[model samples]
Target: MTDEPNEIDGDLYEHHHIVVDAGQDLLRIDKFLMDRLPNVTRNKVQAGIKDGFVKVNGAEVKPNYKVHPMDEISVMLPEPPRDEELVPEDIPLDIVLEDDHLLIVNKPAGMVVHPAYQNWSGTLVNALAFHFQNLPEMKGNDGRPGLVHRIDKDTSGLLVIAKTERAMNGLAKQFFDHSIERTYYALVWGVPEEPSGTVYVNVGRSLKDRRVTMAFPDGDFGKHAVTHFELIEDLRYVSLLKCNLETGRTHQIRAHMRWIGHPLFNDTTYGGSEIVKGTVFTKYKQFVQNCFKMMPRQALHAKTLGFIHPVTKKKIFADSELPEDFSSVLEKWRHYIDHTD
Candidate 1:
């Protein structure tokens, strides 16, 4: 007996309602709304559940709440406020290789891979959406298209994207099976005692800071992470190490390097000392100061990526050159070496 309009005009001052029936029996709250409202997205549905806008039987419900044979489900969808929609930007891309099945691009730093809350435009997805005619849909609840894996927003590297559904499924399986060989180059603070070693640690959610992950000796919910590193070049004070990821975890390279006492330079989250000290301080004192001032993010980059092509079955290898900022740091360090020696 509600007089709510089926649809409202304007972007704001709008509301709607959806009734439940036996057909929706046992459907999760979020899934039910997605089916009922074609315009509403899964993320929007989840946000409504989090904001307590979704109620069942006159009670606020969780996202996983199952519907009965006969239930009253009320969903209040707030109109998006006035804002410019996603405008496709014709940004230049560094495409390494391309085929009908997949495309490999060298992602640059300072570019977001995909859009999320607050960041709706100017992402890699936006660029791809503009460039490509058809992009494969992502698996699971995340609605991003063609993105099988991800790198940090500030960390630049190589990324592989699928162009078709078959390619997406095959590539996603490669990531989960740890078949994708990814090698990263990092300029850490100090040299490790061993030239090459493996770090095996359990990475879990950080209890102190929810935003970061922490290593745990024994924890309830933790995943096994392994990183193998070899010292590629020793620049007197700083060591340039090449890391191969055995198991990909969130911030695995950054966290493991910090745990071993040689954090990457300018890594704020992993306790990289803003000021250089000890051997590094005395060796490249002036150069260290200049680096700390100029470099905004950690010195980490996915230098190499290798895998078997999902469709072609041919081995594919792609590499990215060191960014200008990282190369400049090495140049200063080389100058200090010459002066000190």
Candidate 2:
């Protein structure tokens, strides 16, 4: 990955272009893209086609138009809106590494990375704003203090905060170039077929539920996302997995793993809280429920992160230990699987 800008900007939208592979067969443009674009929907694509946001060979086409090999395609998608004001609060921060240019924080689960809507306080951004009163602001940031990226509120992990505009822009370019390395540890519902493999798919918000993300394996609709995962331990019904992200889309690992039929353990949104693999005996069910009570959130942790230091021109890596809730649940599963078998 190189440090070049990824998006081609228009007046109000971003442009995407693709050329049909030489060996590609005749397929509906909507169908072809439904399986390709990340976090997109068929309806969204069809709407784009109707509104002339999508074009084939420099001409706008309908949703049912057949795409042939070597066809040039382009689409214009609206840019994300600017964020709202950021209010500084006195939330505590678990500072891992801090210097003049940037700081890496070990964020705990259940803390929102930034303040939004009803989450107007107690966020990591609020903490940063309180601590760094004179932090530089990025363009179109509204009032976001020093954020270059974010993690899910329920996913605990390491996050890098930039203190200067040069650092922020440089780090953003690195992410756009896909040069950042992030690894996560997850307790999943079932063991993967292979000890290690990659889930290459498109990820997008579900049409049915906009709150959660979905994966498209047949190239339906979504942003491109890839997760390379390795099995660490098998606990009969569930397993431990280390997932490495190639593209950091929203809910990439969670949606990709769910697409592969192995949702993270205790992840209620993806059907991991239920007994997915164990027997139907009453004792087994009770044991599973007990495990859920022990760790109420999805069993995931951003264990490691690596990136190029913007100031030093050197590589920097940060690793975090699993929180008590996640590790304790793993121990319980190990004990239950061992004793019951």
Candidate 3:
């Protein structure tokens, strides 16, 4: 019997536990814990112990303390309430599916997921607040509500929002375990050399530019991220690809694809805005510029999402068609391919 203190925002909260087996050998508490937690650093565990957040048999214990069988361990940490309010807005939503516990939305490009600096209104959260009056209480970052996961503002597609605490925790766990199935469609600048492959690298915030992420191939920096991609259509100078995310980090698909030499079409943040392919003839340049004008954002969409139902344990899946801008751009590319040769 064991109760562990929950780790939240680098602070300990709700209780957790692990019962030692009868034949278990003595092990240091920190090392023992490091083996159990996923994606947690050893230094983090040691820090938790050093801060007296871990205890054995109702007594605070040191990191190096040896653990024996049947020791009841517990940690106590209180979670302070978040202090912010969401002002409901009347923005419209393109909801695809809704249940008593969850709602699936087909978010359009250019819509911010939640309120942020200079984006305090006209956000998805604001729209949701006005639509659902009986939302469950959640201490979200800066009072954002119901968001279990999110896609980038300019990259539109499907999103699943939790309506209750049970659903939120359930979906959050699925994301943490990387069990949620998500597929994205991207129109990139160049065709991948391989038909299908995976990019395994460390992705974290860029040191040179805080606004974007960078990949660390040698595992020297950042969090572990994996993206699997397959070519769907070859537009010669460009290609349409499907990307499956094994780990969802900020800009995982965008940054990883850029690292592999095929930045998403028109992704200005990673240098996709300028022409990277095709002829330099004035007519050709005008054609390319016209395409850019039609679709100004990155050509990436969250095409599909699948997860187990929080209430029924049944599988739930949602798919989204490309928005008009994305589809129109593809049609232009198809026409270009058909006639250019």
The whole-model C-alpha lDDT of candidate 2 against the native structure comes to 0.84
The C-alpha stretches of model 2 lying farther than 4 A from their native spots are: 1-84
lDDT of each: 0.77, 0.84, 0.84
Residue pairs whose backbone atoms clash in candidate 1: none
* Model 1 lDDT-worst window of ten: 5-14
In candidate 1, what are the lDDT values of residues 1-341, reduced to their tens digit? 13253333332222435556657558787777765654466777889888876677768888888878678766555553333344566878788999999999988877888876566777888888778856887755244677998888778889999999888988988998999999999988878899999988888657545457687756465689999999988876678999999998988898889888888888888876465334555545656777876667888899999999999899999988998888887777777777775
TM-score of each: 0.76, 0.75, 0.75
- Per residue, candidate 2 scores C-alpha lDDT tens digits across 212-328 of 899888788888898999999988789999999989999998898888999998888888877889798999889888888878889899989899999899899999999998999
Candidate 1 versus truth, CA RMSD in Å, comes to 6.7
Global fold similarity of model 3 (TM-score)? 0.75
Report the alpha-carbon TM-score of model 1 versus the true structure.
Answer: 0.76
